[model samples]
Target: MTAGPDPVAPGRTTTSSASTGELFGAVTRDLSTLIRQEIELAKAEATQSARNAGRGVGMFGGAGVAVHLALIFVSLALWWALGDPVGLGWSGVIVAVLWAIVAAVLALRGRTELRRVQGLPRTADTVKKIPHALQGHEEENS
Candidate 1:
């Protein structure tokens, strides 16, 4: 008797004969690869955005320092004008008191705003569901 064609032979082309489970597995693997690629793309985009933002922030920091120096000169001029009425020492003391009050108000507001921030809750929730998705429970709720 002649031997029949072996399905298990090497270099066989799988066509319509592939089972449903095999198709499903292939789809699952493809989907996993696509997801990983998407994740890498997102990471690259985020890094570029962060670098751009860092450069912008550095420029802003330079501008802030320049403005601070200008403000210092303006404060000195104010102190000199105020000195015409009061003594020079009292004018300097008045400028110091005004700056101290402004500093206190800013510190209080910054602390309040910082306290109100909550960290990445939506991202945490999505990350938590990943294990369930891997276990094929992705459509369970739907």
Candidate 2:
């Protein structure tokens, strides 16, 4: 028998073989670069999301201001219409007082709602768990 062509020695390396240390260094470098890229992507997305949120808030504020202005104009028109028939000046004063009260109540309620909205936690729990989730996915894949 021809001794099965002399089985290659277990730890012997050919000229083309990469050392474990070099392989480990390459893998580490690649992983570091990948992690940095992911971090940058996350930051960019967060900034974009913040910008969108700001735009949305600005639009809401503009619409709210417009609606409030329209409400005041309509209230004034009603007051003027009522003035001639019912001692117009007193009617206007009474209407203005009532509208002011109503506006104050609405403003108070809005302030409370704004506080609630502002107090909401900004941190995303899902983002905190991403590394663990990725590890789980890798294990599953393996």
Candidate 3:
């Protein structure tokens, strides 16, 4: 008697499926896409950090202009007031020194804000794990 067709196993695909090369190609494509997405994420993070850095630099520029204007107007008033007690030249020097202190404080504040900016923390963290994942050591690295 002829036997019936072999029964297909449960939870398994037919042997007529894709070849090994085709499966490898699919994995390669997926991996390439993942790498590209990671690169895009890194670019976005860099852009955000650059904007924050720009803001810090802008604060420095604003401080310089503000100090220059204050020196021109407010320093004259201060110098004139001190001119009575001290000579005009010494009073001018005192006003100039005060303005210098104000400029220094403004510059320090801008530097502090710049230091607060963090660059690519998340991106760097994830990138470090990519090699481990590709090597099939993801669990160990994690």
Candidate 4:
């Protein structure tokens, strides 16, 4: 009698046929793409946040500079108006130092916020599904 087609032949190509390696590769590619997209999204968000932070810091710095200059003017005016009762130089120096401290605090806070936006957790979460997806694909293909 003629032999019928073998079911488990290694090179057989059934409708559901795929090698473990191929399935793994496909799943890997898909997961890599997903991770890449997620990373890109995170990077874009981080960049936007950085831009916003930069703008905010710039504005804060500018306002602080303006306030310092204003304080200098006010101190000078007060010194002149009070007939130099209190020295304007000391008041200007104190206001300038206070403004510097405030600016430094704001910059540190911004740096902390940016650091918290790192993308590793999101990438790990997405990568965690890759093995399961590959296993399922392997079973279906088998």
Q: How far is each candidate from the true structure, as Cα RMSD in Å? A: 6.8, 8.5, 5.7, 7.7
TM-score of every candidate relative to the true structure: 0.54, 0.48, 0.75, 0.51
Model 2 scores a TM of 0.48
Off by over 4 Å in 3: 1-18, 63-67, 137-142
User: How do these models rank on TM-score, best leading?
Assistant: 3, 1, 4, 2
- Top candidate (TM-score): 3
lDDT of 4 by residue, 4-37 (tens): 4447764434435556876677668877886688
lDDT (10s digit) by residue, model 2, range 1-142: 2232223754434435656885577667766876686676667667766676677668768978889889878888888888888888888888989888987997887677545443212334334544664465532311
lDDT, ranked from best to worst: 3, 1, 2, 4
- Overall lDDT per candidate, in order of appearance: 0.70, 0.65, 0.80, 0.65
Q: Candidate 1 lDDT, tens digit per residue, 18-121?
A: 56886688778867885686566556666766676667567656876888898899889989999999989999999999989977996786567556444444
What value of lDDT does candidate 3 attain over all alpha carbons?
Answer: 0.80
Q: What number of clashing residue pairs does each candidate have, in the order they appear?
A: 0, 1, 0, 0
Q: For model 3, how does the per-residue alpha-carbon lDDT over 1-142 read when each residue is reduced to its tens digit?
A: 4433336754433445646875677679878987998899999999999998988788778877887786688778888999999989999999888878977997797678878899998888888888888787775444
**Candidate 4 colliding pairs, count:** 0
Off by over 4 Å in 4: 1-15, 83-142
Shift of residue 11 alpha carbon in model 4, Å: 17
Please identify model 2 stretches exceeding 4 Å from their true place: 1-16, 80-142
Specify the poorest-scoring 10-residue window by lDDT in model 1. Answer: 116-125
For residue 142, model 1's alpha carbon misses the true position, in angstroms, by 14
